[model samples]
Target chain A: MTSDAVSAGGDPRRLLADTRTFARRVRVAQRVTWLPLLVLGVVTFGAILVQAVSRPVTTGCRTTDAGEICKVWNPVLESYWLVAMVAAYVVIAGGYLRVARARGLGSRVRPYVIAGVAAAVLMFTLIAAGAGRWIVPDPHDLLNPSTSILVLFRLLTASGGIGLALLVLAWLERNVALLLFALGYLAVVLVPINFGWGSHWSGKSEGAAQLIVNGLVLLLAGAGFALAQRLRASR
Target chain B: MTGPVDTPAPESHPVTGLDDVVHQRVRLGILTIAHEARRVEFGFLRTELGLTGGNLSQHLAVLETAGLVGIEKGYEGKRGRTWISLTTAGDAALAAEIARLKQLIARVETTVPRQGEAS
Candidate 1:
């Protein structure tokens, strides 16, 4: 382990210089893992766009005492979107844990596990609550054929995003850029839903909105990555 | 003419109070990396530090013996892997080293005259 720097009685200057070198190395190491995940996100997002544009819409009907309720269902879009989301979550979680581990911060995994479990429990609890009619009278609103999956997707996004953000913030308390990335990604996922722009093939404006949101998300992510690299390089 | 004038030897420079175990380049690298990560894989440490398998294991053993790092061996998809992480004591030690380094830098800045000032 002895080197010219180390053998120099651990001089503060040497230590600082060495630290910077090590940090740069760590950042380079992390980029190897992060790049692939970024690629995966882009590919998944592209697939969702493709499915949204081409999939045929089917109508789903349900009989009730008052009348029959009907709604358009884009199964292709829904299924593909759900798969993409799940894949994203898996990739994000796995990549995060791997990178954290590589950097020697394995203790941070606890929060991730806790967040995941909490999210799953929340999802089931919502489902059960809706089933029991304890909340909304219409279970369909909470877990209907059209909205249930979307709700689940949103819940997963919130849980995963918030959890990862909290963990990263706790680890790198000074890195506000990470927090921005997390919040930005969360907003990118939730904004359209909040505005009632369902993730289905509707029209040109919908597609345009999706593209804009995705672009913003990628920008935020890229910024966060760049900031991390810069921070590591500087110190 | 005088043959030579006395000058301070480079070897006479002041020493830092950094821990001997933590001072080694490879060990310092390990600690720094571990401090950033929650738990690091043995393979990652080896790759990042550019150490051979045997060499990294030796250093990890030394850190583990010093109680500065913890090592866990487990199986990952039929392959055995080792995970290394800093203990609480290790974290404190690394923080102290960094603090000392910062102080040393500051002290040097205040006491040492630059070329322009010396002129």
Candidate 2:
């Protein structure tokens, strides 16, 4: 055979290497990348479950004031709500992953990461600005389902996005920009909602946890974008 | 005289450029389905995997993040639809993956041990 033909004779090790690399990427996305969220989801859900069983679900059954109502929800209703919350989380999380995957580990996530960071930073600033509190250290207003519902709706929109973004970080863990973007997305939703659900610092912690989540999201998004860009450029 | 120093040029990339190929079983499944059709739907993959929408979605996210598929959301009839397609890179990767796999199989088959002797 000519030297050209000999040069064209392929190497087997290259195929093995490619397979290993591809497998690693898939493995990262599927397993290693998802740990924190899985833990957070399980713990949060468990806490809520315990609370539902333990807490009265209503505060002022005997009081003569605007507190005469009992926490009237049965276990079944609570179960349904649990399922719903999970479903919503799953759906939102799915969106983040999708965006990440589409974007890959590179440029596409830049815009999203920027958007998320902007949102998170904006949220933190807003909270630091102290315009409002949705969930506070106080629960005198907790029974006010009307206001709670309003806050819940907002949480559904903003936090949902943050959660989705957090899930995206599997693909491009190398990008700190992605991590910032994830944090930003988290802050945008959580800073306000933390005022609704928990304490200021806890809200801050929510923001912090969001950083991790957002990191995941950015990685996933980066990977996705990288993959897509690579694919497109090839054609 | 030159005003300022410039960054050094980056090293050249690797040759036999299949590093970016999609080769996993599920990713291959994703590419195969996407390649065969104009667009593959989310629900379709769910049924194929016998997995809930959530699990399939996660996998799809992986495929998407890797740039092997393009997903377009729209409607078929009144309901929302998620349509996925292979990008050009994805197509190339798929083709490369196929050739690579074929090469691996050929290598193994030819190098098969004779009567249990390690070849």
Candidate 3:
């Protein structure tokens, strides 16, 4: 609130010069926050979520065989979510990219966005270890024995990498945000009972996965708000 | 008389140089706006400073000639955009001007200490 910039110990002359650069960065930082990163990311997430919830029920066999009815759309539903997850990654990655680009972060932003994507990739790597299960009727392999401790540990490490990168990004930007939630998700999943819930969330319709994924998405939205407000108020 | 001098001194005391630059409202406003926003479009500066087309043009010309500003043009989409940024010389001058103002305030504050006591 003290606009003239002088503070506890610095000479009046020193304060003005210090404020000069700070004010300049703050001005453009607004431009960066208002960029389209957050909204687009959230929308993509919503779309993926809607598909997860509704697709299984809506897409079914057109032909009527009564007791012998065969569904053509089941395979599409099984694969549709995979494509949705990839799109979700793209949108989420874009949100972080926008924050970096608008801030003129130069080399500072790349590593963080990379880390988040790496975490996503590591999740897929765990999924690959359970690819044997996904091959037939059951895609809910989150806690299946085939998932393996080694795969889970690698996925956890990847999440740790993401959390570290996001922390660094937030520190540089001077905001603490949904970073804790991201870290928390990895921790919650390590418990055997909670671990099954993740797969259950991803598979079971109108269930806990909706709650968790939507809640995580909301947390991301909160982080974006915190980031934008912090930018607007910086100088 | 002082010895013959071909050019003025490169740096001047506050009283010597500030008067010429400070009184031009448009240039000062431009400096303040650009001080807040490190750079702005030429049109934005004109609109924000509220100078007439010709008036803003003349003032900007003077600042540009004085090495206090630089202008460049580019296109955003099909529309042309002109960018204005304070040159290093301009930034230094503005910093010096702010310092000069603070110094003047410091001088006045000592004399007017009792006057501001109520607030």
Global lDDT of each candidate: 0.59, 0.48, 0.49
DockQ of each: 0.26, 0.03, 0.05
Give lDDT tens digits, candidate 2, residues B1-119.
88888989774323444443354445565565555443556765555435567656766788788787888887746978787777898888877776666666676667677675854
| Model 2 Cα lDDT, one tens digit per residue, A161-232 | 345445464333443444564565555544542323333443223334433443444445546555654664
Worst 10 residues of 2 chain B by lDDT: B12-21
lDDT tens per residue, model 3, B1-119: 89987996675444444535532445655665565555666666555445555767777788888888887778866977766778888888777776675775576567565855869
Q: What is the DockQ of candidate 3?
A: 0.05
How big an interface RMSD has model 3? 10.5
After superposing candidate 2 on the true structure, give the runs of residues whose Cα lies further than 4 Å from its correct spot. Answer: A1-235, B1-21, B116-119
lDDT of 1 at B78: 90
Candidate 3 structure quality by residue, lDDT tens digits, A34-76 = 2223433353355455546554432322332222222223333
lDDT of 3: 0.49
Best by TM-score: 1
State each candidate's clash count.
Answer: 10, 45, 1
lDDT winner, 1 or 3: 1
For all predictions in the order shown, the interface RMSD in Å is: 3.7, 15.3, 10.5
Q: Candidate 3 deviates by what RMSD?
A: 13.8
The docking category that best describes candidate 2 is incorrect
- Cα lDDT tens digits, model 1, B8-88, are 766422344667787677888889988766567887777777777888888888889999999988886798888888899
